[model samples]
Target: MSVLEIKDLHVSVETDQGTKQILRGVDLIINEGEIHAIMGPNGSGKSTLAYTIAGHPKYHVDSGSILLDGAEVLTMTVDERARAGLFLAMQYPVEIPGVTVTNFLRTAKTAIDGEAPAIRTWIKDVRESMVKLRMDKSFAERNVNEGFSGGEKKRNEILQLELLKPKFAVLDETDSGLDVDALKIVSEGVNRAKENTGLGLLLITHYTRILRYIKPDFVHVFVDGRIAEQGGPELADRLEDEGYDRFLTETPVG
Candidate 1:
């Protein structure tokens, strides 16, 4: 089943220079239980695409449609999109000074699930997920993303993914800024989440390093704010070997 669909989507941002178009008539469809990786160079609108799908308020869809599970999502509010089973893991997680991780997780759970899990059950689940992510139990009491290392933030996002178990997740460069050990641990957490919940994934990344750990069923090359090319897992290997030079040359600019 097609869980998410982007048809002739155009997105833009307002700036001093006026409207700057980011995504230009981009089209994509992600089915349930599929892993799709979108690879691109910097400023190719990879993150923009993810944020747009998740209904970020800053991004405006200039034209076209985004549908989640057959419903028009472009008209929905950000929280409404989340409640509709979409999740976005940002490239950079923001830190909230006063919100502890446990409190934040429970609040998000309450919002999404319409009721928070019992305190005891929630704590137990959080601890188990933390241990699976190779994190210490003390992390539960720490502020969300505050004073956390790059790897810690990434693992925390995966931890939320596990706890919430969204039907579809858009992971925007989750493997960036991590050491080998952290990468392995984050990859393990992601794999475990997918295995446990069969979550569909749209992974946005530039390097193929993470692909080695979390295999993708389909690979797409985003260039000039649109999907310039797409293929199976072999496409990622080709990009790894040949680089994105051809895509840059072939991609059409609107």
Candidate 2:
């Protein structure tokens, strides 16, 4: 089974005020077919952890290690990480102006698999995934995320997740701007990916609404750049009702 291990990860970012620490020391293990939710308030280092795992240049890993299976992920480039079966769905997916969604997906699949998928089957798979996402057929001809709505972009991210079949996915606030219908559809797509491929998810979000649909096996409460608490799905429900105020109040001051 595929596994991702983050051991005492301390990450920082360079800002005008000088280097600022974000993630203090995070340790988490995700196994195949497990959904782990990292819920926290804004600036609580939720997004930083996601981007750090994806090897975003803006965030620097000050110490510790990120290992996928047995290989050290910190040593891999972003694309190399993806090829290594790691996928990250960004909160704000960028637009590729000239590349059509079809071309982009096809190219990515080819790169990841080290060979192009059979053309007929590939087209069929993409069409089915889009239809399930409620995307119009014309979206395949459009530029990647260009002129797309927030919900559309999020759905496209899941489309990639479904088609790419990554071993692990770090979905960062995928439910942020989606309406109920869109949110449910996107959630279903994520569920499908997990069910079909045994995908291990590190779902990051502030609210529990997404949890109602995705149903994480573990809920981790991130506070002041560290995981202050952890539990099962009940923790998410508690956070939904109680909010993060209690954790915020007792955060260790530096």
Candidate 3:
């Protein structure tokens, strides 16, 4: 069983205001096949934790370790992390103007597997995943996220997830800007990835709508740059009903 452990992680970023600390002493563990939802208010550091784990150069790791099945993730480069079975789906997927979707997916698959996929089977897999996500056939030829609708970009992220088959995926607010149907389709893609590959998930979101479909095995309430509370699916239901009002009391934003 693969285990992704975050031990007292502290992260910071250099802002125009100068150095700013984001994640403060965050800790969690995600075993393969577990879906862990991280819910928090705006500016509560949900995205910080996701980007930190992915080793984004912008986010500085002040201290602590990110371990994946006994390997030190903090020591790995961004691509090394991906090759090691770590994936991050950004909130705003950037447009790669010169890169077609098919080319991008194939390149990523090859990079992660350390060898190119067989052409015939790889094309078939991409098409199947796109069909499952309700993407148009022409989407395979379009530049990645270039002029795509919000829902389309989000669906494409899931398409990559399904194709890449990472051991753990960190989705940063995938539900944002998606309509109900789009949200359901994206969630289905995520569930399919989990069922097919036992993909552990670190889903970061402000709202609980996605949880209704993805059904997190554990729900963590993030407040003041840390996990203030944790529970099962029931915790998400409570957050949906009550909102983050209770947790807002302790946030001393300067």
Instruction: Please give each candidate's TM-score.
Output: 0.96, 0.98, 0.97
How accurate locally is residue 106 in candidate 2, as Cα lDDT from 0 to 100?
96
Ranking by lDDT: 2, 3, 1
The local distance difference test score of each candidate is 0.91, 0.95, 0.93
Residue-level lDDT for 37 in candidate 1: 98
Q: What tens digits encode model 3's per-residue C-alpha lDDT throughout 1-254?
A: 99999998889999999999998898899999999999989998999899898988999999999999999999999999999999999999999999999999999999999899999999999989999999999999999999999999999999999999999999999999999999999999999999999999999998888988999999999987899889899999999999988888865332
Off by over 4 Å in 2: 251-254
- After superposition, which runs of candidate 3 have C-alpha atoms over 4 Å from their true positions? 250-254
Model 1 agreement with the true structure over 1-254: per-residue lDDT tens digits: 64788899999998899999999889888888889999989999999999999988889898999888889998899999888889989899999999999999999999999987998998889999999899898899999999999999999999999999888999999999999999988888888878887888999999999999999999989999998988999999999999988877784642
Task: Give me the candidate number with maximum TM-score.
Answer: 2
So what's the TM-score on candidate 3?
0.97
lDDT: worst 10-residue window of model 3: 245-254
Tens-digit lDDT track of model 2 for 208-254: 99999999999999999999999999999999999989988886432
Instruction: Report the error of model 1 at residue 160, Å.
Output: 0.6
Clashing pairs in 2: none
